[model samples]
Target: MNRKNGITVCIIAIIAVVLIYAQSGISFGDPVYQDMDQYFLLNGQVQTGGNNICTDVVFDFRAFDTLGEATVLFTAVMGVIVIFRRLMKGEEYEAE
Candidate 1:
């Protein structure tokens, strides 16, 4: 490798190592800010009137997000249908 490429790779490796080491305090399956979970577990059923916490979280607290996802998926499907409508109209796809 060229000297310039080697220097760039070394800088990148150092930066990556520093960044990873800096954030090594973060752990999976346990978080720092977790009051929201306790709130949900305690009051999800009472406030949202859902017997299931999973359903309550998905449908009550995150309804707008779920709706947005459904909207995006519907729009994508509609777009694909529009694009392929020509083939649906008595047309044949041929391999060249």
Candidate 2:
């Protein structure tokens, strides 16, 4: 095989091995990490001012995660807008 084909095959084999090892550690259809869930369910309302457990967990306990997701989304949107901005700003065509 050519160098490129050999390299591609090696890379794919490596990725497959890594994925197999990673999947072996996870217990699908089973609650492996229930302590955190139990703690949140028991204390979410008490720790947060909101009486609603779901709201408290999302808005208070996991607010930083939500904020990070929002920030990433905003950044991606801004990047797309920036890339397409020149066309909208009357720079779609120019005379040589």
User: Each model's TM-score?
Assistant: 0.65, 0.55
Off by over 4 Å in 1: 1-19, 89-96
Measured on C-alpha atoms, candidate 2 has an lDDT of: 0.84
Model 2 Cα displacement at 26 (Å)? 4.4
Candidate 2 has a TM-score of: 0.55
- What candidate 2 gets wrong by more than 4 Å, as runs, is 45-56, 89-96
| Candidate 1 lDDT tens digits, 22-96 | 889889789789999999999998999988999998888999988998999999998997788776868774434
Q: Per-residue lDDT tens digits of candidate 2, residues 1-96?
A: 999999999999999999999999888878877998789888877788677887787778889988998899999998997787776866653434
RMSD of each: 5.6, 5.9
Cα shift from native, residue 44, model 1 (Å): 1.1
Q: List the residue pairs that clash in candidate 1.
A: none
lDDT for residue 6 in candidate 2, whole number 0-100? 98
- Name the weakest run of 10 consecutive residues (lDDT summed) in model 1: 87-96
Give lDDT per model, in order: 0.90, 0.84
